[model samples]
Target: MQASEVDYLIIGAGSAGSVLAGRLSEDPGTQVTLIEAGPADRSVLIHCPAGLALMAKSRQLNWGFETVPQPGLNGRRGYQPRGKVLGGSSSINAMIYMRGHRADYDAWAAEGNAGWSYEEVLPYFKRSEHNERGADAFHGTGGPLNVMDLRSPNPFGPRFVEAAKEAGFAANPDFNGAEQEGVGLYQVTHKNGERCSAAKAYLTPNLGRPNLQVRTGALVTRIVLEGRRAVGVELLEGGQTVTLRARREVLLCAGAFQSPQLLMLSGIGPADELRRHGIAVRHELPGVGAHLHDHPDVVLVYDLPGATDLFGLSLAGAARVWRGIGEWRRQRSGMLTTNFAEAGGFIKSDAAEPIPDLQLHFVIGKLVDHGRKTVFGHGFSCHVCVLRPRSRGSLRLASADPRAAPLIDPAFLQDPDDLRRMVLGFKQMRDILNRPALARFGGRELPASASARSDAEIETFIRNHADTIYHPVGTCRMGTGALDVVDTTLRVRGIEGLRVVDASVMPSVVGGNTNAPVIMIAEKAADLIRAQA
Candidate 1:
């Protein structure tokens, strides 16, 4: 077996890992090794924004993980598509650059995660973004990641924004700015119509650096710990077990599910569970897989009255594709370059709350069931999700074998409050879609047979169809609490030279898309690690 050493050994070359590798190696004094379980991000589909749906189920780019049957979801198994490439979900996501609500970060600070407040972390957010609108108090001027508004948004996008207003909502041009209370087109992480994945933003530019080593297809099996100190990692490379030692730290950027599973597999989780799995104890931390949460999304699909949808352009619909391609190629502007969930808003389910709790992602095309092998046409969809869910789930070691996947139970809609709020969210969607503004084009599709007036029917529909919008967090929470897997600085509890730099450390999930936040965490974690060094 080949053995190597690095100053920083980063596991999982995802959003966070890419940033860490790029930032840490900039000094030219630190040697960083980034190991990715998946292959390189070289697919053309990954660059095309609309092509995300086509890659959702592709095993080459996705982990293709499914959740265990949940009782709350009526014994139905949920689908989870995690990114498996260098850029991670950022390479696969819709590219929406939402930073979530201000309160979301303040809640983290209030919960003992110091320096995580909205005010404190705002600079980091700005430091990573290169907005098309240029520099401002809220947006950064020169950064690696390009944040821009859609050049030529979908034809229905503006109508969706107007429809929200007809339903009594404000039109917000920036959700990441002062407020997140209204409907508008979302800012995306793209540069001239191409995806600005973390790898592109942070890694690619610095790939020639001698200090940075990015090894794809390196699947880390376990953290090599000695007396509560992580010294290195054990990985499988080319069918051979290899050992890579880290002199300074071994950071886990393996995401929420994989991070906790690795911790438990390393014997750092619940003692009893470790004993049951026949794994030797490294640390007796009880929160490796606790406080799991995910945003459950319910899609409201509607059939359009005319042929105004993107789905009508099949292989036979080559004219539309040709026109779209020409428009984009000629001027870097077109409907094909934008994420069709072009317009959306945030609203409070209850009147008492100061901030909005429900987030709506409106799409210009019909999307049914993970967009995999489903028939779609000239239709549209409105996905309403509760941003902050009270329901919690867990990820546990099914066995001690490193090759085995962990058992994930997201426990969606387990709490009645979650169901009630989601029902209200659906009601909000229906109200917005039924407005005269949208009625000119779209008609009700799903839940049409059931009376839209009844809360019971809405709740029933949610349980039957609500799936994860792919935002999972809080499994390995960071805080000063007893159950925290890592501290406020993201250092793993009861372990030295080990830190978790990913969405898994989020004490609570943010109110919007998590890719940008994850990247910000990496930026901050890199500074912290550098300071310590």
Candidate 2:
């Protein structure tokens, strides 16, 4: 096979990969190539904020992987959706621009990941953001990624916050500000009412740069390693195998599942596991896919009568949407501009906890089973999840073929403590939903949550209903421990010319939505790579 060469070979042109590709190619001396398994982010569903409401199940834009019957979830296979488009999940997520909590990063620093403390990493976050709120000590203004308040939030969003107030929580206008604990409307990564995915912000504008080459529909089969160092990647494009060598480094930004799956497929994981999968071990990194975890969430849905803000499939709803299209075309603001989870916040279930352990997502629609299960009529929903789950899982090779999906076992709610916490959080969500501020909407709870009042009943409801809130991380965790895959600098511990820069590198999942953190990681990784160069 003829081999092509570039200064940097980045696998997966998603959130992190997009940023890395754009940043590394800034220097004319650096040649960077980014490979994505999915197509370009050109579909309307990718750019429209309302498209996120249904984008979770779009096969063209989502890598719809299912878990192997989570034991913690009563033997039900949980749905795992990662972005298959150029922007990765950022293209399909509810654009909530959250950086998690400060304590989350400090804990990483405490875990031996120097320079990852909240204070150290804040600059990278500010550097990537162009908050519409203007420049401040906590925010930046001229950055690529546009962060703005919703121009057309559902009227129900404020009612959700009002309900929180009635339930005794303070109204916090900014969850990303001085504190995170309270009710508030979420800031979104949007520009002029359009989704501002990482690809749009970092990659699209730099497409003309001669130093950058982006390849879509490239399914990477394996990383080509010379002994313990990654040299390049072997990818299948249009049924043809191609080898692309990196003269400098091969970076993996394939997110949690694929990053470790690629590592294991390339013989860089546990010796025994690789052997079982009929692969020769080149390196025995036991933690390649060992620390997988995600937020375990449960949705409390309610039926709302005469709700014009929430999305629906009825004739009246469709008519309103049809009219909304014209309104959006004219003014760039309308119901079409809604990111359904418009308002949410962080809360501490226990006063003794140092930071908020629970998060709420107040959706403007009645979401069930990640919206996979269709619920008729007009309604709204609220999601409550454990911000930092104690349970961890694994991702392993199900087959030797790289084309095959990896065995994903998120092990949701495996820790009894997580279940206990979910029960507590569920009560808090119910209390807020029951407040008089929302009572006038005339909604009733679904059966699963309607009668579950006691702790035991709530626990049963949790085990049956809890699933992923879309954030899966830590499979290729960064730290100095024996099981750590990468060090503080994000370089593979036992390998050279390789580094993992994505959500997988997080030693622990942050306390909020992960897109912002993933971008921040790539921003920081770019600096680290340039400093060495």
The residue-by-residue lDDT of candidate 1 on 1-533, one tens digit each, is 11399899999988999999999999888899999999999987787777786876798998878899988888999988889998998888888999999999999999878899999999999998899898888999788899999877877878888889998899999999888899999999889888899988999999899888989998888999989899999989899999999999999999999999988887789999999999988889998999889998998888764555444435544567678777776776776787877889998888887899999998877778878757645678889998999899999888988767788888999988888889888888888888887888647675542355688777777888888999999889999988888998899987999999999999888999899999999999989999999
For 1-533, candidate 2 gives per-residue lDDT tens digits of 12389889999988899999989999998899999999999998877788877786688899999999988988999999999989998988989999999999999999899999999999999999999988888888888899999998888889999999998889998887888899999999999988999999999999998888999999999999998788999999999999999999999999999999999999999898999989999999999999899999999999886686688767788889999888887888998888899998888787788889999999998898888877777888999999999999999989989989999998898889999888888998998998998988788998878988889888888888889998999989999989999998899988999999999999999999999999999999999999988
Model 2: lDDT equals: 0.91
**Model 2 residue 1 lDDT?**
14
Q: Candidate 1, which segments miss by more than 4 Å at Cα?
A: 1-3, 313-318, 325-332, 447-452
How many clashes (backbone N, Cα, C below 3 Å) per candidate?
A: 0, 0
Q: Which pairs of residues collide in model 2?
A: none
TM-score of 1: 0.97
| lDDT by candidate, in order shown | 0.87, 0.91
Which candidate should be chosen as best, given lDDT against the real structure? Answer: 2
